[model samples]
Target: MSDQLQNLDLPYFAIFLTFFLAVLSSLLVLAPTQRGISATWDYLKQVKFIERNGIVVSTYIVIAVSLWVVVMIVAPQFFMVELSFHDGTVAADVNYDYSQTPYTFNNYSYVIFGSGSDDSYFNVLHLKVFLRTIIASVCITLLAFVLCYPIAYYMAQTAKGGTVRLLLICLVLPFWVNEILRAFAFRILFGSSGVINSVLIGSGIMDEPFDFIKADIAMYAGLSYAYILLMIFPIYNAIESLDHNQIEAARDLGSSWSRIHYRVVMPYAKPGIASGCTMVFMLTAGALAAPQILGGPSSLWFTQIITNWFNLGDWTRGSAYAFLFLLSCIVFVLTVMKYFKVNLGELAK
Candidate 1:
């Protein structure tokens, strides 16, 4: 089965896949729903103005959106998904001809079970890394919500115009620095002989430099800081859109602060919370830089493993790993949507 797919045509496959996706999307968009076909028709009708934008302008806008969806979003993922089912070794042998690669699930098998060898029959290490990545990502999402919610609420509800502007400046200023530079700054702060340890030892707080990096403290801190803004803004927007009179009514009815938030604020903010959580979880799970720079010697991120496979010219296996990660993220998003009862339309709003 080494060259089983050698006769396959690449262009034909791409065209077929694109056609299939178009049909699928059409069905989804045209389905009978309150906000599906009807909403689309409304949008189209609204496009026709009294001082009309020309048909050419509208055509250009549609073309631009289509190109962005197909070229930027769909094509890369389609190629990756296609690559995941093939054999990289055979492709490499045939001068990187993907058409010559036979299809196999050996890559996914390797993810589930070790090379069919006697000594290591289970891929325990990689599985553990996958689980660790998921768990850490969830923790980070929760932590970001806990930390940012109050600030978002303060900015959206309590703070005056100038105070809100000052808070926004403080939040946005740090992120203006490049992410890599920020990661490096974290490394310097948490490194063995870095500032924290230097201060501790110099001031007689501790005799030896504590290993914050080894404890994975820097990784958590860095990842949290990196995605903090993403978690905050969605929540702020949601809360800001809420009617302040509702909160006042709750208070007038003798509701405590905690009860008011739990009953009134939280239910209204579900869409924002769900959106923030999904983004943070996915970003943290797939993170490379913070894991690379702030992670300890003993630490390993799932993305680093996928990157290694690609770096070693095993694009097939890398694609499989990446696709699997993507599937996991999709599942997480669906679960969150289900739990929060926040659909795509609400999140979009």
Candidate 2:
């Protein structure tokens, strides 16, 4: 086979060809009457083995435990250790030594405390950026949930298919535009000479144009707009799958609207809410573009710090920060899974 075909990794194709030939050969070897006898004999042999179940059960348990150990514990630690060894290296000619030394906790210490050298190290500003990112992510996730839940619930309960379809289309329409273009559009709208200010000034709504770009309000609005659809779809799917009869039954039993929602609808929709929150939190936490454009100079987010470290040839600190963010995402996902009592693996499907 050509290199290009080999690179396609057609192992499954090869397996299918082999299996087809084996089946054809088996059919040729066995006469039509003997096929039934062979099948019955094979079944009897398998049933006889099943009668001796202890060894089979023990072997299955051992295989499952071994797979779990490799997947859950050993694999991640192995990769983290491998990445740590080659974390930081300078490409261009510089006075700094780029020695591949033995692995040590120096990278962790530098990430926690300022290194006070050419090597990029964690600082108070970095910490502030990290904290601000957490705060921003939490705010965005909460606000998205608040806004999305009502719309999702309305769409789920209402029978107006045309209106629901229109709303869903409109919600997803912004995503068709390029993300950077959308961010720039927001930037223009919130900029000093943008349309919002011009209209407000023209209408005498305020004396001066609001400084939205330098403020947190602009960041919140932009990020929320970016991730709103992600928050909506999961909740919508969740609520759609719910049994509306149970909800009507609750109301028939003299339950108030609030009681019906809290008691009947919310529990069923917990999986969707958890899934949506996980997505929104993770996306907002790692947001780079919206903050960079809308936040101006004052609101430097965690991603910008990573960018700076990368620019300064400080891969170690950058990797450390990246890993930390990854850990946070994992923890947040696990927490959501725990709260909803849903297996993340199953929900992800």
Clashing residue pairs found in predicted model 2: none
For candidate 2, give the lDDT of residue 339. 70
TM for every model, in the order presented, reads 0.86, 0.70
What ranges in model 1 sit over 4 Å off?
1-53, 91-95, 118-120, 199-205
lDDT of 1: 0.82
Where is model 2 more than 4 Å wrong at Cα?
1-81, 85-101, 116-122, 336-342
lDDT of model 2 at residue 335?
A: 69
User: How many residue pairs clash in model 2?
Assistant: 0
Q: Total backbone clashes of model 1?
A: 0
